[model samples]
Target: MDRFVFAGRTCVITGAASGIGAALALHLARREALLFLVDRDAGGLARVAAQAKAAGARDVATEVVDLADGGDRLDLAAAVEARFGGTDLLINNAGVTLSGSFEQVSMDDYDWLMEINLRAVVRTTKAFLPQLLARPGAHLVNLSSLFGLVAPPRQVAYATSKFAVRGFSEALRHELAGRQVGVTVVHPGGVRTNIATSARLSGPDLDGQQAAAAKAFSEKALTMPPEEAARQIVAAVESRKPRLVISKEAKAGDLLARLIPGHYWNVIARVLPKGL
Candidate 1:
């Protein structure tokens, strides 16, 4: 496929209120793309919409929708269809983190994370896929995680959701191979974001100390800036790359997983510091 141009194209991005999604809105705006942003954070969405307009977006729209709610997700899909008719790009980036071992993590927390991280992705994609296929050329971007490729301790729910995303994106890509729609799955390794701070914790060890340690580790280890990560993602989209693994750590993890297969955990355990 030729390079995916952004100028004069309609693009929709979920989780557009902050992190990589906000950065993507700003970046694509500079390319003069029409922007449709969605998020539960109304205030942040407004701020990002303003910034996108200032950055030279052709048009900017925002919908404050909680993806966790099926009704809200359907409303967002209907609004997009009614307003834009179709979109050239749909990026599913909304996700939350859950901290704790699988055995220790509550079923409620597991369900919550699965709903937002996994089920929401499926719902939004189904809602927007028709519009994507209607366009001459379209792209779908799904944000998986490094943990998706390589499972680690204390992130069972988060990893499970991401792994599902990876599998779904791959299958969708194959299914759309002969069509104009393209699919890209992303594996981001600890970008500097509030995900850790906002992450819900469970387990017998859940305390102020553990929470503080996790936050500190996330802040310290997640060295890649969200803006940089967004830049890479946009570049991948422009090139129609199938899979984009952000950061050197993410790339190394991918390689290790492929090379070691079942033994990757041994290597990762030694490399990753304690409390991470």
Candidate 2:
């Protein structure tokens, strides 16, 4: 397989323990990039690191840091700089999920989700972005969701965070355009990652609703494999694409949102089953 010219780059991927992060790390390893894998789960990060090294990473390492903690993210950057000098690619892939009515959402749940989903992106980017700018043609990848493009019924906090991510990515891209940094905002549709299975749903009496949504979600959706999504994202950066939609469904939804504006929500509304 012909790989992209990522051979000499130092790639830092957050949430690298599993899901798309692990897959991206694996793909980049095949392209011979140096990998700095970050995740709160130490054991999972170790597994990803071993896979990257086995696959073909020039050098592979791991950092166990909870991105939701601002102080932890700072320490993580210090460790990265201490170990690897500087990064050529920084991917903000760490995220969490929440589902409930905005009014029913607890303050703790709201704050925790915000910290992980939105604030961590800001913190990690601020920490690693300088290293990226110092190098020529550096890259930054922010993993926004299809929900970020359009609002849905249940995911109140998650939607707000993704919206922030989408806006931040665009703004950062423009700010860094004339400079050497490149920013690619990724919007992936339903991916066959364990995120849904592991997601935390809130609301005092919403457990039944959550279970029903989970069931419906698994049924009607065809989640593309994480490997395929990872490939699309890496390819986008190599090709200098500013915005990337990982699945055909995502692309269609994005286009529809653009074409009819508010009507996109109507489509989603119609698609929703009773419980979800």
Candidate 3:
């Protein structure tokens, strides 16, 4: 049987407890990789580590951390360097969402969003890059959103963070392309994740029913299974693409955005709702 090529190398994933992170851990574990899982949810990370053990991962380590905690980044970096010397694959997957207008999002909410979605990537990359550069083949993957590409409606803060991720990923890729390091920025349309269920409600609460309805609308309109999304992402990494559009719909949207540019933003704004 053919295995994913990450065997015998260390792979560190943030947000490794749930959704895409958990799923990708499973995928890599089956290939007999060593894992360093990071998440704020200690219980969740334990569950994931157990599953990875069952799936034949050679070894596993866990760190419960909040990405928004400024000090946590340095701690994780130190831990990674101390434990594994360097990571072969680095995935900056920890993120959060707020489901309302920008005005509805408080200063704290906006800052928190920026910290997790954008700054954590920068922090982790800078911390781990020296080791990654030493490896003959190393990969860095950042989880961006389709909203980053086309500027969809009603996700101002979330979109802004992802937009920064895209810019960062692209620039990093070009900068490293001259060397051995490879990067792939994922633009996922909507993978069926619990983010919608756990989204922060700051200004006006969307009661459970309203939130469910909104989630349902998005499920119908955009969401896909997380495993399928992960498969496509891994494939993109294997192929060494700098950018990946994970779903068919997401690909179409990204394609349109690239071809039409200004017209694409208008089209996206028309499709999505004005508010949660």
C-alpha lDDT values of all predictions:
0.89, 0.84, 0.83
Q: On a 0 to 1 TM-score scale, where does candidate 2 land against the true structure? A: 0.93
Query: lDDT per residue, candidate 3, 1-276, as tens digits?
Result: 122277878899999999999988998888788899999999999999999999999889999888888753666777877888778889898888887777677989888889999998899898888878888578899999877887766578888999999999999998997677889899888788887667777576746653765577566664687888777777876677788888877887888889999798777656655543
lDDT per residue (tens digit) for residues 1-276 in model 1? 778999989899999999999999999999999999999999999999999999999999999888777553666767877777778999999999876678878998888899999999998898888788988679999999998899988788998899999999999999999799989999999798888887887766535765786688777788788999999999999999999999898899999999999899899888877656
Please give each candidate's TM-score: 0.96, 0.93, 0.91
lDDT of 2 at 219: 55
Task: Give candidate 1's TM-score.
Answer: 0.96
Ranking by TM-score: 1, 2, 3
lDDT ranking, high to low: 1, 2, 3
lDDT of 1 at 95: 93
Counting clashing residue pairs in each candidate, in order, gives: 0, 0, 1
How well does candidate 1 score on lDDT at residue 242?
Answer: 99
Report the candidate with higher TM-score, 1 versus 3: 1
Task: Specify the poorest-scoring 10-residue window by lDDT in model 1.
Answer: 68-77
The weakest ten consecutive residues by lDDT in model 3 span 1-10
